[model samples]
Target: MRVLIVDDSKAIFMMVSQMLEEKGHVGIWAEDGVKAVEYLQENSDVDVILLDWNMPNMNGPEFLEKNLTDSFTKTPIIMMTTENKPDYIKKALSLGAVEYIMKPFTNDILFNKFELVDEIA
Candidate 1:
């Protein structure tokens, strides 16, 4: 799987990238939603997007709202953030995110979410 990881922190990206690599998947890093959108325009083959809720340029929910009418909407998005509130999760799902993974998650949790996404797809 080719996963786009949209997060402001390099450390978090590195961690997720390593996990993906270990599982034989490719991980692409986008510092913010603006960059993610730009990348998506040129490369729409991405399997899934791992989005962060509090980015500087464009947050996860903002990205979800903006892409609702775009072709990238076909790509499944999983909001990965520290926001663990039920309201936040519900809002994300309502806005177009297929799944939500709270931050500080383990590798098992991350991949398990991926499996859930596959089932949904």
Candidate 2:
């Protein structure tokens, strides 16, 4: 599986990439949503994408908007964010996120998300 992680924090990206690697999935990184969009323009076939809520240049929601409407890539997105507010989750899902996870998530949750990704694939 090809996983793209978009987060401003280098630490978060590294951790998530390592976790996905342990699960035997190839992972890629982008510092912000704008970078992620650019990467997608050149590369399709991304199996799953986990994006952080806050980022420079373009935020997660902004990316979702552009990705959903401006491009042909309809990659499934999992919102990995520190924002735990219910309204935020609702808004994200409404905007095209497959799921919204709070920042301090566990491997179990990650596995569940992957299972769904598998189903989608």
Candidate 3:
């Protein structure tokens, strides 16, 4: 699986990338939603997106809203963020996110979410 990780923190990206790599998956980093969009425009092979709610230039919700009409809309998105509020999760789902993962998650949690995404997709 090729996962597009949209997060502002390099550390988070590194950690997640390592976790994905352990499972023989590739991780692509995008510092923010703007960059993610740009990357998607050129690469439609992304299997899923692990999006952060807060970021510079563009946020996860903004990205989801913007991509609603784009070709990559078919790509499943999992909102990975510190925002644990039910409202936030609901909003993300309403906007088009297929799943949600709170920050500070373990590798198991991340991969389990991926499995769920796979089932859904």
Provide TM-scores for the models: 0.96, 0.92, 0.95
Native-referenced Cα lDDT, model 3:
0.92
Candidate 3 has what TM-score?
0.95
Alpha-carbon runs more than 4 Å astray in model 1? none
Question: What is the model-wide C-alpha lDDT for candidate 1?
Answer: 0.92
Worst 10 residues of 2 by lDDT: 66-75
Question: How much lDDT does each candidate structure score?
Answer: 0.92, 0.86, 0.92
Clashing residue pairs found in predicted model 1: none
lDDT of 1 by residue, 1-121 (tens): 9999999999999999999999899999999999999999888779999999999989888899888867564788999988789999999999999999989999999999999999999
Model 3 stretches astray by more than 4 angstroms: none
lDDT tens digits, residue span 6-113, model 2: 999999888888888887887799999988988988999688899899998999999888877886468889998888889899989888898878887777898798
lDDT of 3 by residue, 1-121 (tens): 8999999999999999999999899999999999998998888889999999999999988999898876555789999888889999999999999999999999999989989999998
Where's the lowest-lDDT run of ten residues in candidate 1?
66-75
Which structure is stronger by lDDT: 2 or 3?
3
